[model samples]
Target: MTKTNAGRFFEDYAPGQVIHHAVPRTIKMGERALYHALYPARHALYSSDQFAQACGLPFSPLDDMIAFHVVFGKTVPDVSLNAVANLGYAEGRWLVPVWPGDTLRSVSEVIGVKENSNGKTGVVWVRTRGLNQHNEEVLSYVRWVMVRKRDASSAAPETVIPELAKVVDPSDLVLPKGLHFDNYDFTLAGEAHRWDDYDVGEKIDHVDGVTVEEAEHMMATRLWQNTAKVHFDATVRPDGSRLIYGGHVISLARTLSFNGLANAQMVVALNGGAHVNPCTSGMTVRAWSEVLDKAETSVPSVGALRLRLVATTGAPFALRGEDGKYLPEVLLDLDYWALIPR
Candidate 1:
């Protein structure tokens, strides 16, 4: 009898199956310090307790991505241990701010699955939710991954693709309790631009780039407890190169956006995202953003801006080609809503 656990394969999943992922993590300032070191994240609201208090938060909470990564990491063992690729995401929303000392865990429900014609692999869609120790739901999203079958001859499961929302309605976005940006300080935040300053369809080149490093990426993957074999084991890929985690690119692009969008503080919702291309170490990642739309929130001075953040290895602003396919140089395309001072 084998004592070691082998993660779920495509055939092992069924619609409506719920998986309780293991290993709850207690977040602390150490994680925050390491996160800042790994990525160039310097949002004022997350940087200073005074700054966050000024904006009506109790104190500086953990970076939103920290909570996201922690929750995502917890799901790896059960959800994507045998994954070939993490396909995409949709209808994600952050319900509560994660404060230090909070313990977080994750649970996922198998919402959909489809057998690929190739027979060797299939796609599994799961809706995952992150909850704190109090069992309060903090973050939720739907993600699909391509996973290999334990046996090529295994029978395929009935295809069931979930009908996911194309976008999270603005009215459904959750605002952090007491999070009013009425007394926002542009000088301290590093950018004077407000919600009114940005127009729809406006694009901004962040004008910065960071070369992905093998050591840094490994440390980051370990920090988040992401154990996907392709991210750490070079042997997993045919070329013997460890693939960069998609979340790493997402965080890097979000950090890079601070150059011109410093005031766009908290990410309230993730409408959709795609990892258009795989990234590897030694490539320089650059980021750019386009304001998709803007809307007023119920908060006194807080507004929401729908933005598309793009990560690329090539020139800035080049996205899909004439044929409606992602350009070879594009790495990630993410659509989300962020809170900004009005």
Candidate 2:
């Protein structure tokens, strides 16, 4: 018997089956430092312990996306190591602050699966939760990926497409304990705009761009411990280029949004997201965001804004085309709820 791991194929999944990802990562200041180096992340709450204390937290927690990346990275071997593409996401939530030194692992349950017409690939949907060492869930999300089949003649599994929410209800958003912005400092936040400053349908061009370097993409993927072959193996795809990890684009887009949304700290909920186009190294990425909706949370000092963040290489504010298909220039389209000072 071979000891090497080949990862799970599409046929290996079944509804209701659970998988405990094999790796548990202990995140620290070093991860934060390297994350900051990989992306231009500068949210004050995550930058300074003093700022976080002023905002009523004991200390600055890791950036919300750091928890996300760590959580996402751990699930790759079991969930997406054999994936052809990670298609979409829905109903995501960041439940607790991930403090420094917190160890995190992931558990995923197969929720849906369906074989495609070609018999060469199938789509698998799973609800994955990132749990701390205490077994407390820090983050959760539903994502579906297209995976290749190990045997073309294998019988198809029962089709089950899960009913998913298009948006995470604001009432269900979990706020970190003791987090308040009653005395928020706009000066330190880097942008004067508060939750009220943004109107629904308002669009903000972040007005910045970063060229993705091949080495940086490789480094970022390795930093997250994402072991997908597509990111590291240029020979996997017909094109002789390594595919940049989607999380890299997500972080880069979030980093670019800081210019206009500096005060929009703490990502609380991820409603949905899509990797519209393939992103490879050497493409310059730009970002824009539109306020989709707004709601008041129970926290007296905090409010939530639902924003559609778009990362693209072409132009700002251009998404779908006449056929309702994503434009060729768009890379990622993510919708999430963020907390802001009231």
Candidate 3:
């Protein structure tokens, strides 16, 4: 009997198949400390327990991205081990706040699949949910990845691409229980800009850049427990360079946005996102944001802003070119909804 286990390939997935991932993680203060060290995340709600309590939370909750990374890490072994690329994300929601000492596990259902015309690879879509020790779902999202087929000669499965929403309805966003921003402290939050201060179609240049280092990216990926070969093994790509994880760019860009959007605190919904271009070590990442829209939430003094966050290496605020294709300089394009004080 074989005692080894190889990860899943494109042909191994079928619509409606469910996968329960392994290794539930119990998050603590160490994860929070390392996250702050890895990225320049300084949002007040996630930084101070007193700040969080004043907003009606029991105490400070872990950064929303912390829960995202933990859940994403658990799915890598089963979902993306043989992936060519993690293509995109859509319709993601944060259902519950994750606190210290909460244990989390991941469960995924294969939602759709379509083989490429070349037959060497296929796109697989899965809806994954992160659940706590009490079996309550904390987060949910849909992401699709391009995965290599183990045998190129194998027949392709029937195509079943899912019809995903282009954007999450503003009314559907979940606000943390007891969250009220009426008493939000602007001085401590580091910015005085409120939700009403931002107009639709406005743009803000974040004005800060960070040069990525090989060691830093590797450490961040390892911390998330993402075991994707393309992120670690140079031999996996023809260019002979490890590909930086897309989530890394997302976090970097979000942190950079604090310069002008310090009050856009919690990311409630991921409407859509794309890793537009491959990023490697040594690129200087700059970020910018465009206010797409805004909405009033039922929660007291809490509002939502729809923003487009773009990450680039050549310059800030340049995205698609004349051909409507992402420019080579563009690294990440993310569309999401965030909570801000009204």
How does each model score on TM-score? 0.99, 0.99, 0.99
Candidate 2 wrongly placed segments (more than 4 Å): none
lDDT of 2 by residue, 152-212 (tens): 9999999999999999999999999999999899999898998889999999999999999
Error of 3 at 128 (Å): 0.4
Candidate 1: segments with Cα more than 4 A from true spot: none
Please, what is the whole-model Cα lDDT of each candidate in the order they appear? 0.95, 0.95, 0.95
Candidate 2 all-Cα RMSD: 0.7
lDDT of 1 by residue, 116-213 (tens): 99999999999999999999999999999999999999888889999999889999999999999888999999989999999999999999999999
- The Cα error of candidate 1 at residue 103, in Å, is 0.2
lDDT of 3 by residue, 1-342 (tens): 988767899999999999999999999999999999989999999999999999999999999999998999999999999999999999999999999999999999999999988899999999999999999999999999999999999999999999999999999999999999988999999999999899999999999998898998999999989999999999999999999998899999999999999999999999999998999999999999999999999985999999999999977778889999999999999999999999
Clashing pairs in 1: none
Instruction: Determine which window of 10 residues in candidate 3 has minimal summed lDDT.
Output: 313-322
Ten contiguous residues with the weakest lDDT in model 2: 19-28
TM for candidate 3 is 0.99
Any idea how many clashes model 1 has? 0
